[model samples]
Target: MANVIVAGASRGIGLELARQHVEAGDRVFALVRDPDNAGELPGLASSSGGKLTVHAADVTSDSSVADAAKSVDADGIDYVYIVAGIVGKMEPMLEPGDWDTFDEAIEIMLKGPLRVLRAFLPKLSEGSKVIAFSSQLAASTWPYGGFYPYVAAKNGLNRMFRSVAIDLKDRGIVVGTIHPGYVQTDMGGPDADITPQESASEIRKLAEWWPLDKTGDFYKWNGEPHAW
Candidate 1:
């Protein structure tokens, strides 16, 4: 079975991805900000028949990510999914914005993916696939406006991964971004379009089959090419 790492797998879609990989009998390293408070990840690992390991990792902290990456006792990682994010303030630009949350969004969604990638590079083998979460709002074609922090962070994340895909193309390391739909979860809220299970299921398929030729492209959870 393939070795998979699901970063920010404390709950929601991240937790669902961890569960899916564990059930598939793949070795899964599930990372969270607090292992002690990682909700179902601990129990899932306990019952995963040695297929899952939980580690405490704060994407905002370099040392924490490095330490967590060191805990993955594997010869190579086949997949690395960076799924940590914060909704932050759903507001338009004001004279004085919520700078703390805005800063947090950039750190977690933009810089965070890069940090996780750097720490896990040693474990990633050729042909390994890395997918990070991006939002439809990040697309330039999307005309709607609002949620400045979330939109900006996702935009930055998409470009960063795109550059990475270009950098790692010769090595056959596929890198791309996915918009996990408007999934119904704590972050997506109740009025979202789909459930977490559905979103994760489709995303799993993409992670498995998304090609090197299509690397650097952003896609929807349903496997459709998303607008840049």
Candidate 2:
């Protein structure tokens, strides 16, 4: 079985991803901000036949990310899925509004994934694949406006990991970003287009065979290429 790391596995898409990985008989390292209060992840782990582990990790912090990776104690990781994220406010905010939303968005969306990847670098084998979820709004081609902070952060995420893919190419690491479709999750809200299970399943399938040639590319939940 392949070794997998699912950061942000407390709930939503991350939790679903962890569950699916365990069901697939792959080794899973489920990282969350609070292990004691990690919702259903512990229950899922208990049923994983010892293939799933739960670790405390605050992706916004470097020390926490490092500690979580160190706790893995694995020879190498085959797949790294960075799924932790927060939704910035949907509507426009004026200058009077607090900048915390924007700050939080950039920190968790832009930097969190990179920090996790950096800390877990030593644990990743030659053919390891790194994947992260990006919003379609991040693309310049997206027409609908609003949600500036989230869009900016995700835009940065796409570009940052693309650069990472280039730098890690010689080492045989593949990095990719995907728009998970409007997944039905707490963040995506109840009216989203697809269930978390649907999104996660398709993502796993695509990621499993995603080639080194398309290392820096973006894709949709159905495996279609996403325009930059």
Candidate 3:
């Protein structure tokens, strides 16, 4: 089984992904901002027959990511799933908006994943996989202007992962981006069409059967190539 590290595993799709990985017998290192407040994670891990370990770290903080990386340095991880993100209050780009909110979204969605990748690069084995989460918004322009900043952040993330894929190619570290569909998670909301389980299953399949030639490609949960 693969030694996998999943960031933002406290709730939503992140939590479900951790559960699925542990169920599959892979050793999961679940990174969350608060372990004690992780309602479903501890139970999920405990029930996994000791296949999960929880670590506390804020992806938006450099020191926190660094410390978490140090703690997991000896694990020899095979996959790092960067799934931390936020949906700031929806607002148009031109309106009197909270610039701070936009900045926070960018920090969490773009910089956070890059920081995680840099921190965990050393612990990754030669054939390790780095899967960064992007969004469908990154490809298609939203008709509503409210989520402009969020979409921009995801677009930036896609580019960053693509660059990392090229840089790490010689090291045999495959880096790719995944755009989970509108799953019914906290972020995706209840009216969404797909479930977290469905999204995770599709993502797991893509991770396992990732084409070497498409290392930097963007993919949807259903394994179709995303335009971007």
Compared with the true structure, all predictions reach lDDT values of 0.92, 0.91, 0.86
What pairs collide in candidate 2?
A: none
- In the range 113-205, model 1's lDDT, one tens digit per residue, is 999999998887678999999989899988987888999999999998999999999888999999999989898898999998999999999
Which structure among the candidates has the greatest lDDT? Answer: 1
- Count of backbone clashes for each model? 0, 0, 0
User: 9, model 2: CA deviation in Å?
Assistant: 0.7
Cα lDDT tens digits, model 2, 87-185, are 878887755878999999988999999999999999876789999989899898999877988999999999999999999999999998999899889
Candidate 2: residue 112 Cα off by (Å): 0.2
RMSD of each: 1.0, 1.0, 1.5
**TM of each candidate vs. truth:** 0.97, 0.97, 0.94
**Rank order by TM-score, top first?**
1, 2, 3
Give the distance in Å from residue 77's predicted Cα in candidate 2 to where it truly belongs. Answer: 0.4
TM-score quality measure for candidate 2:
0.97
Cα deviation at 114, candidate 3, in Å, is 0.7
Flag regions of model 2 displaced more than 4 Å: none
Inter-residue clash pairs, candidate 1: none
- Lowest-scoring 10 consecutive residues by lDDT in candidate 3? 140-149
Report the alpha-carbon TM-score of model 3 versus the true structure. 0.94
